[model samples]
Each structure stands twice: as C-alpha cells, then as structure tokens.
Target: RVVGAAKDLPPEGKNYSKRYDSGEDVDRVLELNAGTVERDNINIGDNVVVENL
Candidate 1:
C-alpha cells in the first residue's frame, strides 16, 4: 500500500526513478539506482514512506 506521494522530498540529493512522471529535482532527494529494488519495484510516480534506518 502507498502511504503518500510528494512532488518533492527532503534532504537535497540525487534521486533516480524508473518513471519520470514526478518532476522532482534530481539535485534533491536521495536517489536509488535503477533496478536497485526487485521483487516489488518502486518507480518515480509511486508513493512511498521513509522509515527510520
């Protein structure tokens, strides 16, 4: 289940997404390498939640 979707994320950094639906700036938001996730993949347009590491 998707928690939420944001056009922008916190912590400025590069973020990668399979889809480019989201116009989030690449300079901001930690980006995950393409294909880094498998089984269940999360794309740019997909909503997600960040938990405490």
Candidate 2:
C-alpha cells in the first residue's frame, strides 16, 4: 500500500478542474507492456515500484 498527495485527480472532473483547490485519492493498478519484461525467468509474483512525476 502507498499514500501520497496530488495536485489533481478524478471525481472532481474528467479534467483537472479542481486542481487549484485540492486533490483526492486515485488508487489504481497499471499493466506493464509485454516488451518491458526482458527477462527469461520472470516470476508471476514480482514486486515493482513506480514513481509519478
């Protein structure tokens, strides 16, 4: 699990209409492209960390 702050998010609007006011929770999962896994023996359960900028 992870906790952080954002300058924009959904439920406020499809676009960032309430970005200037405050942000909200945005929890979701992302799928990695098949080509990104360049390992021969990649496991099914692997831990990955991604940073958004």
Candidate 3:
C-alpha cells in the first residue's frame, strides 16, 4: 500500500536512475516503504533497479 504510493509519485528528474528528491523527501519515501523493503531484504546502499509498470 505505502510502497505503491511512492511508486505513483513522479520521478525527480529525467535521469535513467529515476532518482527521488533528497533529505526529508528521501526519508519520507523510505519511511513509507520500510516494511515491504525490509521484507524484500533491501537495505540502505544496496544496488536496486526500480522499473515503472
């Protein structure tokens, strides 16, 4: 649910990496998706590829 919300947000820029905004924005994103992210074994500094559906 929360993760879906984050995905729905537009990407920060035109970069291929699909970066999100930083600082508080980044913190908020992580906060929202923390549960599912943790379940998937993803961690800070881990390399991840997010695809748009």
Candidate 4:
C-alpha cells in the first residue's frame, strides 16, 4: 500500500452524505496509509481508539 504523506486531516465536523441522505458518515475520520500507520508503530489487527480533542 502507498504511504500517505504527513498531511492535515480534514477537520471533524458534520459531514453530509448524499447516498444515505443523512450525516451518518459524519465521524470526520480518515484512514492513513498502511505504511504510515506501521511507521507510527500501529500494527494491523491492533485495537486502537481515536478521540477528537
């Protein structure tokens, strides 16, 4: 997988979903590349909890 460069993630806020016609997908979360994650010492299958500050 391609490693994503260190970039600012989209801010967390209300997200509008056209498919569901709702904001259900508004967690405002994005996934980093596998390599990027691994570089941060997070291995695959590891349980992780991320909270917005």
Best by TM-score: 3
lDDT of candidate model 2 versus the reference: 0.41
CA lDDT scores, all candidates in order: 0.47, 0.41, 0.47, 0.46
- Candidate 4, residue 33: Cα displacement in angstroms equals 5.5
Tens digit of lDDT per residue, candidate 2, span 1-53? 22322322335455655423114354554434444544433343554567983
Candidate 3, residue 49: how far the Cα is off, in Å: 0.5
Candidate 4 lDDT, 1-53, residue by residue in tens:
12223344454468844232223334334466546664777553455566883
Candidate 2: regions farther than 4 A off = 1-28, 39-42
Q: Arrange candidates by TM-score, highest first: which order?
A: 3, 1, 4, 2
lDDT of 3 by residue, 1-53 (tens): 13223434544475676554543334334333436665686555566565672
Stretches of candidate 1 off by over 4 Å are 1-28, 38-40
* lDDT-best of 1 and 2: 1
Cα-based lDDT at residue 10, candidate 2: 39
- lDDT measured at residue 2 in model 1 versus the true structure, 0 to 100: 33
The weakest ten consecutive residues by lDDT in model 1 span 1-10
